[model samples]
Target: MNDNNARRVVSVIVVNEASVLSRITDLFSGRGYNITSLTVAPIPESKYSRLTIVTSGSVRVIEQITKQLHKLIPVLRVYEHEDMVEKEMALIKFPISENLSDINTICEAYNGKIVNVGENVVIAMVSDEPKRIDNFLCAVKRYNPKEIVRSGAVALER
Candidate 1:
């Protein structure tokens, strides 16, 4: 990409209705834009859903995406995160043979804890800034994680 193309985070608030996600995604796919990460969740007790999308594009392209999003009937608001707090969550499963104490220490250091202790594995969960989560994942590789699941970036403007 050129210097103008940079990673960006955007949030779309829309009415909680069926097929809304497909329409929004279709706008991206139809335009040939790539969504690097996407997270959708309902606003608590509200009839709205928040769609957080991460993508890479120039300012002009991003502006076009925002304008298109605004045109969608269900979409109420579209925001490009400039000043926001962003986070992500990850769940990691490690072999039971790993040192539980050492693992617990590492998890605690990263604001995580052993959430489950199965017969053959231990599960740990952490929610933090995306970069920190990436660091945590790298640091835990030594423990031989059996499986790992990660959530996409979520953000709220500050």
Candidate 2:
């Protein structure tokens, strides 16, 4: 990819209603824009949801996407974050035979803790910035994770 094609984050606020996500995603697909990560959740005590999308494109393409997003009927607002706080969560599972003390130490480094321990597995939960989360995943490779699930990025503009 060209250096001009940089990763960008866009946050969209929309009405909390059926088919809203479908319509929003269709706009990207119809235009052949690829979404690297997407996170959506309803705002508490309100009929609105925030969609956080991560994609790669040139500045021009991002401008176009922002313009198109504003055209959607249910969309309440759309903005590309210039200064924001971003985070992602990851859940990693390891074999029960792994050393608990070592695992806990590693988890603590990433703001993680043992959320569950079972007869056959140990599950850990970690939340941090996307890059830090990536580093955490890399560091935990020595433990041989049995499974891992990571949530998409969620961001708030400053």
Candidate 3:
């Protein structure tokens, strides 16, 4: 990707109602934009929901998105992450027969720890920077992770 076309995280607050998500997604698809990661959740006890979208585009394209999003009736606010605190969560399940001590040690190093241990599997939960989670996943291959899932980035301006 071009240096000028760096990835960006945008937080959009919109009315929690039908067709809002589809309309936002349509706007991106219609413009040939790509969303790398998208997460939507209701703002607790509120009439709005928050959407965190990760995408890459030129400065002009991003500006266009901001302007267009503002025109949407349901959209309340849009924020571009600039000097923001971002976090992502990941869960990995490892074979129970694997070395539990080693997995626990690795998890501890990354601000993670055992969340549950079933008869045949161990589940670990970790929350950290995106890169740290990626590194943890790489280190976890030795333990034979049966499955892994990662949440999309959720950021707040610090």
Give lDDT per model, in order: 0.92, 0.92, 0.91
- lDDT (Cα, tens digit) per residue for candidate 3, span 29-99: 99898898898999999999999998888888888898898889999999977788888889999999999
Evaluate model 3: give its lDDT. Answer: 0.91
Q: How close is every model to the real structure, measured as TM-score?
A: 0.94, 0.95, 0.94
> Model 3: how far is 109 from its true place, Å?
2.2
Give the Cα error of residue 55 in candidate 1, in Å: 1.3
RMSD of each: 1.7, 1.6, 1.6
Quick one: ranking by lDDT, best first? 1, 2, 3
Residue 7, model 2: Cα distance from true site in angstroms:
1.2
Candidate 1 C-alpha lDDT tens digits along 1-158: 34587888999999999999999999999999899899999999999999999998998899999999999999999999889999888999999999988888888877789999999999999888888988999998999999999899999999
- Colliding residue pairs in candidate 2: none
Report the candidate with higher TM-score, 2 versus 3: 2
- Stretches off by above 4 angstroms in model 2 are none
